[model samples]
Target: MKQDLVVDSDEALNRKMYLVNNALDEIGFTWCHAKLFMLAGFGYSVDSQLDAIQSSVKVVVDRQFGIDFPVATQIFYVGLLVGAAFWGFSADIIGRKLAFNLSLLLAAVFRPYYWWNELVSHLLAFGAGGNIATDVTIFLEFSPAKYTWLTTFMAAFWGVGQTVAVLVAWAFVPSHLCLAGTPCPSSENRGWRYCWYTNSGIVLGLALLRLFWFDMNESPKFLVSNGRDAEAVATLHAIANKHERLCSLTLEELLDCGEVKDAHDFKTNGYTVKSVFSAAVAHVKVLFCSKKIAYLSTLIFLSWTLIGLCYSTFFNFVYIYIQLHGGNTSGSTYITYRNTSISQFVGIFGPVLAAYMVTFKRLGRRGTMAIGAIITMGILFGYTTVRTQLQDAVFASLTYFFINIYFACLCAYTPEVFPAIARATGGALGVLFSRVGGIFTPLIYYYGLKSGSSVPIWVCGAVIGFLGFIALLLPFEPTRFRSV
Candidate 1:
């Protein structure tokens, strides 16, 4: 009997692994989706759009909008925040696959509308909301506990997307047809309108790829929890086939384990508004219910929040500062922007560094996050003290390197702390909090510019670094512990 039990357990494990691989395949597409969506929305092409509008309709549109440039930027960001909230909740209620496909479809369909009116601007924001939320949830759900740390590398695709956006903009903008009669030697070759149309096409193509070629299996974990045993078994078999692995236990055996109910009668009758509240509440409880977990969640949250704040604050103002201090002309601002883009491209090494640390040393999530935080803090301090343009650029590049590392750590750490059931919601909560810090970053930079002081930079740096120290107190050590 004991030998039989051992054999059964081994089979169960194999089936689980199969499911995980299948999930990972689908989740991988989300990373690509997120990268493209973010790039198209906020990347270098966005700058081109603003430039075109500024040259063509600045006086008329600016007056009609009744908002200055800074305010308009804020409005755009606010739209992003609203989108995040709206779509994040929707993903939890709907299945991950549906949300995933919808986000891509919406983004692709509405992107071209940007040329017609500012309505496209709002659509872009909405699309971003769907893209990020769905991507976060699906990726977290599909990843296996053992390799969860890879989520950060997946998240870094966002940076890749941003990099591609910058490169494309560099290649196309200014050389394209001039907007508002602002002439460039290369203007004869490129047109600003072409940028929007091209991006729209790319997103639409990706959407179709997801819809037709990609298999959209429902998460078995989710299916079991919802009392869909047969469907879950089918999904498990599909997973096993995809991974080319043998699953020892049959669906009947899994049903016998008592983890899943026999009846499909498990209804949502008990689910209510209060149910949603309870779900959210339970999410917090899982994190803070244990001393170990509480310490881990707090530390990661603080670290990510501060990281978001510092990154947003610095990048928002970097172009203006570089132009004023680096002695770049208006015409060369694009070049300066491209320089930062290059810095980001080089910064991919940071994620690579994180991948190595987690895979080789098995430092786990907490240790990696702590290390990244320390490096980021040091880089920020260096950035504040540096005065020369060349030194500034170098320091900025170094900072990005560490920031990317920190981001990778954060992406891995946040989801690993939660139970599979709550993973997506928990990740979303962390992202929401981090974005709160990001939201205020622009305001902080605006004030800093007006005051002509490095105080904001220093203070922000200190706050973020301090949070990292606090993160060490969190309970769950993902490197040492497996996901529940």
Candidate 2:
């Protein structure tokens, strides 16, 4: 997926991408957009909930398994990093469809093992990484340029996901939790398993909906880049048909512009294993083919890493921190989880507000992101002043609210920044770096605990605050139409 229009030259590829972009802009928002939004956004929902379960249930699992160290999240990040690199590279080589549906399906099917078993979390993390990596790209490929802002709203599902996770934990965990300092069998206190089971069924249902009911075609951009103009046009027309609208793009017009890259030309070229590896390398090259793109990609990679660290530090260990601070004494386990649910619920507004914030002539995506990050950092610093559980909940809620604004904007901005062909590859790398930072989060927490419990929050908050200034350095302001 190096160049568009199956063209031999980058110039021709850009021209054809422009044409395809025009045709899609004419389609505007439609039923296909709506359907893809939900399915793709469901990917976000599942990802957050997956993370939620990991954090919320870790203490319970620790007591049950007699684990002294919290390594589940660290192992999960390793799987996430590997998955991002592997599936992301393949998404461009094959298509987004396989990675999209396959990730969730793997999560659902791979859930039979014990929760503490590293294999279970790793497999699920791999699926989560792959799907979250491409879900935005698929949605962006379908969306008309005019509706790009709507992409900001998709992150709202993240709030929904964490909320669901918190509620699930609330319902079963409080009553069945193993006592501290006691190693118990799963039979005595495994309410976390019920939470996992419920979420697995939910993930499975969404996977089925996407795999069978939804006609999730390959990305039109991916198809066009691979020299499959006819298929691209057919996919476009199919969407038009679903919307009962007319599309004027034809294979002849597309091909008339220029020849396309014959990516699937297995007859002429056997598409050896070398081709797959080459495809990955080629996509990475395309992502940084220009000085402008190189600088942008570099900063973005750093941004992802920074955000990943901040998110993992706060969310992954917040529950444990709260528990140690007399979370039960603060108001009982029910209150702790109820506060979590409330925080996540309010966090939903973050993305919704971001949707409107991006449309402002001044804030745009970058400004909104910076503002969100800086504000969240302030909340983090102020959180140390909280001497009560109510203050902790309030600070936690504010943290989610502001950081989500940054997160939603980041998700929307990444796909638009990368070229159509390298979109998935670029995104996967971004997610990979984030997971890289996440892998270190446990060590950060461990050392912070050695010095003082509050030190991790200070470090994470400052890094994110610094990330805000970095956001301002990004020169690209995506246009209302296809800028890539």
Measured by lDDT, the strongest candidate is: 2
Residue-level lDDT for 247 in candidate 1: 44
Question: What tens-digit string does per-residue lDDT give for candidate 2 at 115-209?
Answer: 54678899888888776679988898888777788789899999998999889999989987777766677777868778888888888998899
lDDT of each: 0.53, 0.80
Give model 1's TM-score versus the native structure.
0.75
TM-score result, candidate 2 = 0.93
What lDDT score is found at residue 46 in candidate 2? Answer: 85
Cα lDDT for residue 304, candidate 2: 94
TM-score for each candidate, following the candidate numbering: 0.75, 0.93
lDDT of 1 by residue, 337-359 (tens): 56656766777677777767776
The lDDT of model 1 is 0.53
